[model samples]
Target: MLFRQLEYLVALARERHFARAAQSCGVSQPSLSEAIRKLEEDFGVPLIQRGRRFDGLTAEGERVVVWARQILADRDALRGEVDAMRTGLSGRIRIGTVPSAATAVPRLIDPLCTRHPLLTAQVMADLASTDVLAMLREFSIDAALTYLDDDVRAAFRVVPLYREKYVLLTDAAWAPVRGESVSWAEAAALPLCLLTTAMRGRRTMDAFFAEEGAEPVARVETDSFASLIAHVVPGRWAGIVPLAWIHALGVPPGVRAVPMADTSPAPEIGLVACRREPESVTVQALLAAAREVDLRPLELLPRMRMPGPDRTRGSGQVGP
Candidate 1:
């Protein structure tokens, strides 16, 4: 019933324990446990299974946890709206972006941070589309930079931001590509290092490969997109990557991003947020900012180079 109690429930769902969840919420274990009990009493059903240690949530508890997230997100939105009315706009915003967007992040985050000095900004690197949805659902993330198919993500708020197509980045040896497009069977024959099967991007590639009834070889397999860019240089190896990343990440000098013809593989990447609730200022700013970027296909330019400053290896691995 109470939002704070719902917060406790969400926290418990995340941490799966009272003491840890309470610590995260900055409350004592008993107080937090009591809140959960009260919520169960209010609902007339046990939310959590109790034992010497925290077992798990009941079926009712699992359902309530989803409601709790939605309710909490609504509360935060309401608070943000009221606060915005009073003050010029000050609130923390959490964002989850795909690894392919690494180069675009600084361009986005720097301007936002500059515009709102009082606001806190947290940027997380996310690689999986499912994880992106989960974070948005749990209110752990305000918005995610990803693309979703209707079946995969029909419930959330989606804004079409950019449609990034895949490009084959190869070392200089293969330049002035033979055809207007390349096929998966042909692509498979070329020496290529690709992202592991874990990444959605990789899976997307695999699907394309499957369509051609061919599988590409990965002499070098990495979870890092940057590593994919790094490994496929002009002289030796090749990789398949999003064109946006080439410009965003400033591809290595030896690498060349050649658009795969015959196979026009384009995935719609966008800003995904919870349509169920009003967005926070930071989240709103992100949406506004995303609209500002007039992103187009990277290979449109006949000749271009990766210009952005290279970034340090991200501390977090791409989560599925």
Candidate 2:
């Protein structure tokens, strides 16, 4: 079948609407349909379940769609590789990241872009770790910045970036004495705002609480770290966030971040890419960039003295 026909089939599978699929492909509805019909003739199978409106794909169509995605991804990779060999890496690298890694992803992308100025980075943050992996499997993203668990390690090629450490973020009025670390039990006792249960970071935090025999209930739950931070800033609720978050996005005035006293080993976060036979050049470049990232700033976050109430908002400076 022609590549154009495969493109139409994939678009139809994604949009699930004949008109919309044609619109997305920048072709008329009849043209898209004719292409699909021709593709079916070539394959000798019915790809789509026919109806007046758009029906679901046939079992054969479903299988073809999977192959289509892989073929398209490989085709793009070939183009990217040729372009990079002639010029520099000049295409968009779509990245999917969990919200907790918001601060760390930049360390990977910034260097990649600096080295390859023609490359563009598209970051989709606030996804759950599981969702990030799913997107990577579906070829929706070029790479992922997420927790490196056993499943991830087994499934993808992982380049460990940094271990994520937790901290308690709250208004200074509600914070512990300066330089004092907060325990899981102590953090759970506070009126806390946390990520929703859907997020892997929240699940990790919940496990920590379980280990401490503390089942602290959240006063507020949200999927967005920004929303959780907003709740903590009000002085009525505290939040558990990655220490790297404070280093990346400093707290506003009147807010303080206390290191978590838990001795449990932190979870490792990493750059994950599919283990295809011929990986995309952009993905390879990203892996190289990830290896060269300076994680010392994050490593020092726990030992550094966090700013006190007197410190200026968003200064991200260590106190003496």
Candidate 3:
């Protein structure tokens, strides 16, 4: 059967009405009916159950519907692959990022736009590692910049850009002094206003507290990153902030961030994408630019590698 016929069949199966499905496909009722008939003839099966009204599909019809979806999805994917090859990097790429990556996008974008003038990027923010993995699997996003969990390495391709350290934020006059650093246990006991439990950053901090054998008392919890900073104003409360954000926002007046010392106090944040056989040029461009982005003063660094199935390339042992 033709691609259009399969598309019509799938649409009809979804909408369950010939006229509505036809309208959805921008085709007439007669055209859709004729195509369904053609598809049945091609498959030697009565795909749709006929009645005076909109009857449902037969047993074989359901099976054919599954194949139709696969064929249509594959057809579109094939077209995209061919188009990208001929036109350079010109398609859309959806990316998932954490709240902290907002400032870094311009840096990454500056170099990317210089190379691929026709390429377009859609960067989504505030996604956790779990959300990132789900979106990548659903094909909702081409890649994600999120925390790198150990299991993620086994599930998809990951490119670690940097390790973000947690810092103690407080106003200068109200801040505690005489210590080079503080442990998570000491920090937890203080009255603070931090991110709510919904944010993955908070979840990480909770885990750190669990390890340190302390429970924090947070008077105010907010979802917004800006709110986290706002809470730190002049003894109202103290909160945790990523070093990247401090670099981007600069040290706010009356705010001093002390490093967390005496313990390993950082988590690796990185980019992840599906390990496609023939990665789209747009994806390749993003991967290349991500590698080249400056991530110094931070602990971890991007382990640049060419797009392939080799684990060694992405293992941080080598650079592309």
Candidate 4:
């Protein structure tokens, strides 16, 4: 069957309507319908459940849609490989990441883009650890930056970035902690604005607190670090954030990112990508750039000071 027929099937599965799917594909409804019919005839199975209106895909259709997505993705990767060979790697590399690791995307992109002037990078953020795996399977993202958990390490090719260290970001008025660290229990007692449970960072924090025989009840829950910082900057609440964030995105006035005393083994954040034979040039460039980065020195640096002009946040490229 033609690739266009598979494209039409995927579009129908996504849009769930004939006219709308046709509109998205920039084709007439009758044309799209005819294409779908032809696809079913070729496959010798009904792809869609028929009625006066669009119902849904049959079991066979659903399976075909899955294969169609994979075929399309592989086709695009093939084209990208050819383009990279003819004219250097020159396509967008979509990088999905956990919220906490969002700030570090530039460190990876700077070197890659510098090497390939034609390359562009898109960073998606605030994704759960589970979602990162799902997006990779669906080819929704080229790579993911997240904690290097066992399942991820086992399934994909990974590049270790750095171990994430936790710190309690609090207002000076509430807890004046400078050049000193605080224990988890003490921080838990203070009014807090925390990342929502959906965030992997929040889950880590919760596990730490649970071990201390206490549960953290946040006064405010948000998935965005910017939102957490906004609440903490007002001098009434605190947030538990990664030290990587403090170094990458400086804290605002009245907020101090004090190191937590708990010295358990922290999770390592890394880049995860699909393990394909003859990997795409875009992914290869990213791996090469990752090897060049030295996060060891940054990890050894002292806690970040209050925000300043030189300590500006990232370019706001991180997704929600």
Candidate 5:
């Protein structure tokens, strides 16, 4: 019946307990129950299953919860738009990023912050690409920094930012005896610490190795890029990282990095936001900033588009 009543119902569904739901809504249990009862009466549907205890929502209630989430999101977006119109863009834009794509956040955020001084950002790193998409879909994050591929382009609108080239980060003692660049096979032979296979970045690396007919095992597998750096810094192991990371975080004193001359095409990493007809102000601001971001620094150069045919292994070049 009322927005607050809808809020109460949503809380009840999320917490799945009357007492906890009331606590979450900062209302007494009786007040929460009364609100839900009124909501059900107004809709002429028994939203909640009645019993001795708080049972789950009814079938219709489940659908209501789904609608409630979207309704609340749209309502919040409307409020954000009004606030932006009144006092410029000013809100914390939550940006989720795949661990390997973390460096791309600052590049997108800085321009927005400069243009809209009131705008602030929070970056959650070490998220897998799947997690990034999940958070975006749930409205948990305003945007995400991830690889823009066919799998995601259909769900989220993408603004191409950079083409991430691979690099082998190793301690000086562990680097190859040959030249500056490291090949997939040579880097694979080292005592390696790499991102967990669950991450798309690690999967891409795995695909590269598989294509080269090599099976390289990592000494350590972690979700955090910091962990990889920590291992490499102490001479414990080596890892593969993007050139953006080396530039953004810089290689620590004990670590050295060389570009991996993998002949396979590089993946294009970019900003992805939900494809809403009327995007929230924060999302709009981020999209605008992404459009203006300078990809030259990352050396994406022309910034290739996604979902093209995989480059053929011309000349059968699998290694450096």
Candidate 6:
């Protein structure tokens, strides 16, 4: 039960390959194997299923891997806590965020770093919401920025950040109608570029469309917001996107962001972390920052107005 042995076991579980696990741990394959063997002897049970190649973990090994991850996480937490007490919070906080929520990461991290100057932040911004939660459970990410729902609330500690409001993004020329806002039915009628079905945001949009009895087919499907913007910028396809995205990445020249008129209560996005007995100091800091940060700027984007008859086409202005 040495910490090194636990490290090797956890690495093996993560990589699922003996060689890769050893490489990750910066140790030789034999060293990693011997450490695990000693750990197995101490436990008096087989932890890894043996084979020429790395087979999956045994049932007991699976259980051990779970414990190993927590133990390692706690070890890191302890070190972080001590360092915080001695100086201030100082460490890397890894955050996994859904694509739509990526724009909000800076709002959370900027203040955290200002308060704890030594603390650094790493963001993995392209993950799906499910993957964000899965990584949180595995102790891979310190926090998650994603849609907050009942299922997420039950499993982890969450700090509600903001609501994600939907908007239609299009080149003014491609806009289905000129208005301060657009209906889901009107949005569905246009050539659209949307996130693939795999994304939660896309699913949410689908539900919105379903409510209106509109089944808008995508002219182009993509996983990334950059790609979504790319398609919409050409004035060929319109995109339904979060208003926060418009705030984060300004509408391109000739593009318009019309608020969704028939949108229901927007989905709540939040900061989520594991609910351990003693939470990670990094997570605690993030939660604090989230609570204090004012996200009203995202909600206050320039109000859209219907273009006047004399207004120039492709001007890209949202308001009069």
Regions more than 4 Å wrong, model 2:
175-179, 302-320
Model 4 clash number? 0
- Best candidate per TM-score, number? 6
- Encode model 5's per-residue lDDT on 1-320: one tens digit a residue: 57888899889887999999999989999999999999898889999998988889999898887787778778888888998999988867889998877876887788889999988888899887888887777676778989989888887799988888877766655536256576787777887989888788889998888777878889899887777777777777778877777667665665556668756878888889888878898898888888977775774211222234864332211122
Q: Give the Å error, residue 293, model 6.
A: 0.7
C-alpha RMSD of candidate 5: 8.1
TM-score-better candidate, 3 vs 6: 6
Q: What is the lDDT of residue 252 in candidate 5?
A: 66
lDDT of 1 at 215: 78
Query: Which rank order by lDDT, best down to worst?
Result: 6, 2, 4, 5, 3, 1
Q: Specify the poorest-scoring 10-residue window by lDDT in model 5.
A: 311-320
276, model 2: CA deviation in Å? 1.6
Per-model TM-score on C-alpha atoms: 0.81, 0.91, 0.70, 0.87, 0.83, 0.93
Model 3: residues >4 Å from true position, as ranges? 1-81, 299-320
**Which digits, one per residue and each the tens of the lDDT, describe model 1 over residues 41-69?**
89999999999999999999999998888
lDDT of candidate 4 over 260-317, digit per residue (tens): 7765677889999999876777888899899889775445424443346666333221
- Comparing candidate 1 with candidate 2, which one achieves the higher lDDT? 2
Off-target runs (Cα >4 Å) in candidate 6 are 303-315
Stretches of model 1 off by over 4 angstroms after superposition: 105-117, 152-154, 174-183, 233-236, 277-282, 297-320
Q: Model 2, range 200-276, lDDT digits (tens) per residue? A: 89999999999999998998999988788888876788898887887777665677777788667889888899999
Q: Please identify model 4 stretches exceeding 4 Å from their true place.
A: 15-20, 28-30, 51-54, 175-179, 297-320
- Of the candidates numbered 2 and 6, which has the greater lDDT value? 6
* Model 2 residue 317 CA deviation in Å: 9.1
RMSD of 4: 4.6
Per-residue alpha-carbon lDDT of model 3 for 31-76, expressed as tens digits?
9999999989998989999999678999999888877776665565
Task: State the local distance difference test value for candidate 2.
Answer: 0.85
